[model samples]
Target chain A: MTLQRPVFPLLAFIAATLMAAPLQAREALASWNDGPTRQAIVDFVARVTTTGGPDYVKPEERIAVFDNDGTLWTEQPAYTQLLFALDRVKALAPQHPEWRRKQPFKAALAGDVKALAAGGAKPLMELIATTHAGGGPEDFQALAAEWLAHAENPKFRARYDRLVYQPMLELLDYLRANGFKTYIVSGGGVEFLRAFAERAYGVPPEQIIGSSIVTKFVLVDGKPALRREAKIAFIDDKEGKPVAINAHIGRRPIAAFGNSDGDLEMLQWTTAGAGPRFGLIVHHDDAAREAAYDRASPVGRLARALDEAPQHGWVVVSMKKDWKVVFPETPKP
Target chain B: MTLQRPVFPLLAFIAATLMAAPLQAREALASWNDGPTRQAIVDFVARVTTTGGPDYVKPEERIAVFDNDGTLWTEQPAYTQLLFALDRVKALAPQHPEWRRKQPFKAALAGDVKALAAGGAKPLMELIATTHAGGGPEDFQALAAEWLAHAENPKFRARYDRLVYQPMLELLDYLRANGFKTYIVSGGGVEFLRAFAERAYGVPPEQIIGSSIVTKFVLVDGKPALRREAKIAFIDDKEGKPVAINAHIGRRPIAAFGNSDGDLEMLQWTTAGAGPRFGLIVHHDDAAREAAYDRASPVGRLARALDEAPQHGWVVVSMKKDWKVVFPETPKP
Candidate 1:
């Protein structure tokens, strides 16, 4: 089949004009307060996007990766996924009787945050594995969506998805407006993240890189289903961040953003690349609005990265000062 | 930073008008000969893209996956990657004196296809592992590009990249023009496909899902590098196609195209979904233009898929009758 030839000149002129509209009227990073942190981001984008400039990167090569949890959304008091897992344990306690007596399960069931934290990563990993498995990918997505819809953060008194940083949303929009493809690289389960990332952040499922469990293709009563297995396939944290980025993205990103040490290596690997690069860390210092434990905190700790940020030319974004407003609906501090 | 309020009415109208141009004058699947096959493709696209229609899929859900090897290009005489591996074995033969005595290596060195085939997938896998590994991803990409630039298909005497099917190229363009995201879900090495898929086929690296090797992130003299390990990570073929699709894309595709049984499950998974779906198999029956081998061929064997096409509603496209031309530059047969 062939299309009728159209009046090319008029259509071409219109497309060209419309294409230039975003460039002329870009309200970029509106939630970011006027400071070195915001300036650094704007400057880096300008340098890379300027045509014929030394640091100019092609649109195809202009890739930006963002760490999700604390970087994009809230990961206070406890990681959101951990909270989900704990809630899941309580919900499923009737089915698994041994969970009522098990250490992590017992702690989870009793809502003892201190005891759950005391057991360390092993118990947290166990909680994740048990809760995030046995269902098909679609089933898991539905389950996560259902929980996320009703679940509220105790401190914020709002749904977890509603707690996404307004500054980060603007940053994402700003980068995309400048022709940079933004991807979410998180330490959380990919299935869990996919549930709300699209609607909450505008990041698509294919653009999300996160830790995942082994998902097998099985025939369940003649229907093909991707069964999520109780085994970790990859962990997109620390050094694993760079590894997963390469495995999924196939190229080094020009810019990376994160809030914790889990994202340290990703920042290192991204900024270490030749040519113009950027790495920014979101330092959660807004205790008035959100929890602020960082360096010594078990979840989303920021010790080594905090100390090494300056050396790597990584900008540490002070959440309390740099962001005009934390959440989309939150009053400006 | 805030953008000045601009005159938006004019630009919005222009954008709306341009967006409707493709719907009005879509020159779709030009290289496809007019037949039931072309009609099926066009009809499926129309059904899914029609707004307010019962089968109308959202733009985000209009994902179309394609198998890379036989479906997109000529995998005649031998698969292109296998041929590259054999050539690499020859190129590196001087360094490895022990390969002179090794059965598979000896067979590879002698260009003994029958003997190599007799060794089954093991020797072929070993060849892939040994030849494709031992370098960082960038280095491997460079190596692959260097080889692909020089390597020629013995049958066609054309570079492998140059042998991509014209009809398939048109189909890709058609799908993209109609708001469908096209992805290459291949059994070939992801790195190998990444080397040329972007430039040659317009399919980006992230969108190219395929077999991969384990890659590690480590510091080389304090410089971060992803060290490509010589271990098979995942094979994206047969059932693995759906598995990898779910892992990478996190959703079932609306359309799938392939020329071998390796794509059966992917097609099944796509078409069996509860909506408008399309599955196409390219039957390479034009011996004068391209090689014709189906059920008995060791490489790209098409049997079960061909047998099940009728039941699954997959359109079987005969290269001789349904395609106006084969390769991009090849004259109509």
Candidate 2:
């Protein structure tokens, strides 16, 4: 039953090499561009991190929180997780009659995106509550895995998982390389996001503070089950983002990123801190490459925040103008 | 299965008040003027955290790692976890006879502390391996919980769970309140420590980086089981602390706390950071209220590092001289 011991020595060697390496040589977001937006991020990080800098922030106070949907990854057409939930509802449709008659469910099952959108946030939430609620944490996690494995974006015909933005992936890696313990302070359901976040984002489930359904630990059939409770613990969107960040992370971030007004409060909270801070908003201005919908978009609307960007000193990144590529494959578009 | 919607206005109001409340002030550790030792800890935290201060460290870089045994909680006489392992050995003894005759197991069964120590680290490790290995993660967690609920410290006659140091508890709470994400980086088995850490230390299992037996995802009797892989992933003690911290936490800690030479590497790693950092070593100098053994003690010994404390700028906290109280109740010798 004893563990074989040789693995320790190998790990030890790798760790030593990593520690001994110079921090400056590490891969970082700074490698991207010399534009004001990229420079702002680099300068802010440098000012807060440098020992003698006026805006120097201590290592303990270096909390940098990120919004997941459009901030860390692409949230286009509809939130990718919502797509998963829709697929889950389809898979579980045989068991329930209520879903067939349900407005949003019926619309979703009928492949009527227009009808589903008309149902608005309330009905969308209902769809989430149906598929995401009632199961134990593990059961929900398995369901998420099952759906993610087979689910594809209808328009692009690409696996939903493959649609994550490449630049944001590099940004996460860059932030961590600079001693920032990156956290996903998102509007997505915590459990649903957590199910595959560790693999996709490298942010462990514990570090992900997001919207959550209330869950209770109960003994079901003599086994412990973390059952989805009836109440909603926290909805991490708009004002809820800052509230959830403070409650779960227990710290104000030094930097925040978002693409829409939903993340406005979080960005304000991060910038309000004493030290140097960065707030960047990714503007979807590239219609030729990626689907460009901003001010009028039903999902991830950037209207109110877009107007307030200049006054807040937030970096409004124009997707078409600033970036050399949109998706990982730029030549195709 | 859908969650019932509750009135949102009330919840939002309550959440706002909670987030907006002023910091809960507690009695300062600095007020205790037992010696410069206590002052050192306060000074270290202040210098590192204060914005615009000479040694200011940012919130993102504020990683503080603490050793569980003899640091956060008591590990006197023998490690509380080792005792749990021994009790588990006895509980499962009826099923296995080779353990009754085995070197370390025989000594453990005989209740001979001297013989158990005489068997050295290898045998002690062997005993632990035999008892802690083989079982899946959940099984081990359940076994740990059962033992913790019932096991009492032989000398104190108090449940092992009740033996935590009150001051250290306050320290953890205070640090966490000040934006530090506290993690337990211990030599104790990861799964074993995880079973009780959340309840006892308020640290979630994912934040715990420690020695571990590798486990694999497998289907056991048609149910998915994270089966114990016969490989040691990492043994988090001494030199292993920094390595494990790097691997699991992916950040070098700004502050590190420990009581023995086993934690020296972790302390070294913490202080090696560019900006502000702190390292505190607990010196067991009390013999009247609590068992005092340091340089010569086989258990939780602080020999090598304690000898060169001043040179390394390490703060050596004398238990008897610095603290007005030792254990929660001020244990009688």
Estimate, for each residue in A1-333, the C-alpha lDDT of model 2 and write its tens digit: 111223344444444434322234224443344577666766666676666778877665667787887766667677777777677778889997787887778887886665665444455666777778887665787888777777777756776666666667667775665567788878787777777777777887657877666555444563323467545555678766765554344446788888888887777667765657778898888778677877778778888878877876988887776665555553111
Relative to the unseen true structure, what is the Cα RMSD of model 1? 2.9
DockQ value for model 1: 0.40
| DockQ of the candidate models in sequence | 0.40, 0.02
Most accurate candidate by DockQ: 1
lDDT of 1 by residue, A1-333 (tens): 223333455655655545543332125677788888888988888888778889999988999999998899888767788889988998888899997788778889988876675554456667787888999888998999999988988878888888899989888888887788999998888999999888888899999988888888888897777888878777778998998888788889999999888898999999999999999999988899777878878778789999989899999999899998888975222
- Give, for candidate 1 chain B, the lowest lDDT window spanning 10 residues: B17-26
Cα-based lDDT for every prediction: 0.84, 0.69
Write the residue-wise lDDT of candidate 1 on B232-331 in tens digits.
Answer: 8878889999989988898899999999999999999998898898999999898998988899888888999999999988999999999888988752
TM-score of 1: 0.94
lDDT of 2 at B333: 20
lDDT of 2 at B1: 12
How far off is each candidate at the interface, as Cα RMSD in Å? 4.2, 27.6
Off by over 4 Å in 2: A1-27, A30-33, A118-120, A229-231, A329-333, B1-325, B328-333
